[model samples]
Target: MPSNPTLLDDQPATGAPPSSPSATTIGDLEAGLDRLQSQGPPARRDLVRSLLPVAAVVALLCVWQILSWAGLKRSDLLPGPLTVAASLADAFADGTLQRAVATSLLRGVSGFAIAILIATPLALLLAQVRTLRAALGPLVSGLQVLPSVAWVPAAIIWFGLTDATVYFVVLMGATPSIVNGLLSGIDQIPPQYRSVGTVLGATRLQHTLLITLPAALPAYLGGLKQGWAFSWRSLMAAEIIAVGGSIGFGLGSMLQQGRDLSSMPLVMAAILAILVVGIVIELLVFSPLERRLLRRRGLLTQGAS
Candidate 1:
């Protein structure tokens, strides 16, 4: 009897019995995904979108160059962008920059992977058990607030100046944020989602796998992004503080070496390298994944910042 065609479209067709709620929800999600996929913007717009950030970075570097030239006497203390670039080039030519980047990235990736494996199951367990959540949720959140650098000394003492220490710091830094993100996602799920799954005869595992996870993905992915940031930061701290000849030289070690030699250009170069690596990971890995997810959920429009 509804006058709206859209309303009628959702209703049973020609006296057919109503579709189950779970079926209706699934169909809606699939239709939304397809619609969003077809609505993506033109390639030209995507090109422009990508160029904006590059332009901003160029402008910032120009300003840095101007400032460095303005203060000739302080140039030794505060090297210009060009000086930093030249230093970076020298490091690259000697393969020090490349080796440091490779070592740091390997540790970061491995630590983050281990954190994910540990956090996911622990998060699920905490979500299911009210008593455990009540007892441990605050502790997990508290851990996230603690600076990752603080864990460096403890890790060094417990595991020595080896790779084990770096990984321990990374795991400690990343896992809490991931756990909190999943728990928060689970909390946000509507009661009807659980009821619908139960009514459709879904087993406990089926309900979690099919319904819970997909619904919780956005927040979970956010947590994963934050977790990676923490892991990288923690790895850097451990490398700087727990340096040993046995451990491979990483970006942190390069920065520390610069400080020891009073080489401002090398210090600036190392810092720039760290920033570049983080930006590359963000753009090449997380950004695309996040955009795809947001677009699929109709929360983001193509070419929108």
Candidate 2:
């Protein structure tokens, strides 16, 4: 047997290169398992994600406090968060902040409502008729890009420092945004949706309202959110210029007065008040709506807030 060299070549040692299924070696299985384990979501990661902003804010406050302790020349200019918080409290206690907030909200919400009423019909007209879209699409886009603040001066000239001026500026800023949002949404609808109603024997108007508008809801919501932002900004800018007119002085006026009086904390508080309003709105209204919509559409995946 030892002498037969031919036997060695014919009998081959390592077994018929393993069956196809055996191609998955232990190392391959281990690597695949490692990949899956790495991808697994952690419970704590969600909690940490929610707290990160709070942590960052705390860090920023610490830095500001340290800077103040170092006796910087601009300490007055860069007041600590606590100082601004105190000023804000005082404003609230005296009804100043409350009055300004109420006045501003009234103007902003009114303008926004009017914008929606106007912008929706306009957007619908453009969306339904190719001719109108071609004629005014660029104009609408241009108006959206133009700063809302720029409208403040024009509004004053037109309305002469009344509540109407504030409303005008807010409308100018918000209307274009709402129209654009709705138009964009309408554009996104599939061609099939238009005919879906026609197949069901709907009249042209009925078809549009039932099929097309329903399909454009996401885009409409986007436009609505954008309109609110525009309205708020425009209202603030108008308030700054139109104070002591027909309306009570607003947050913008408070800021201007703080500046005139050289009250750094007051100025900071006013600025913070503006920011807080935006944050509160997003948290209470916009964020929840967006998240709910996205979650429903399977576009967003996150742990419970």
Give the TM-score of each candidate: 0.84, 0.80
Per-residue lDDT for 169-224 in model 2, tens only?
99999999999999998889888877777778999788778887878878898989
Model 1 clashing residue pairs (backbone) = none
lDDT per residue as tens, model 1, 157-212: 77777888888999999999999999899999889999999999999999989999
Off by over 4 Å in 1: 1-46, 301-305
Go through the candidates in order and give each one's C-alpha lDDT.
0.89, 0.83
Identify the leading candidate in terms of lDDT.
1
**What is candidate 2's CA lDDT for residue 275?**
75
> In candidate 1, how many Å is residue 214 off?
1.2
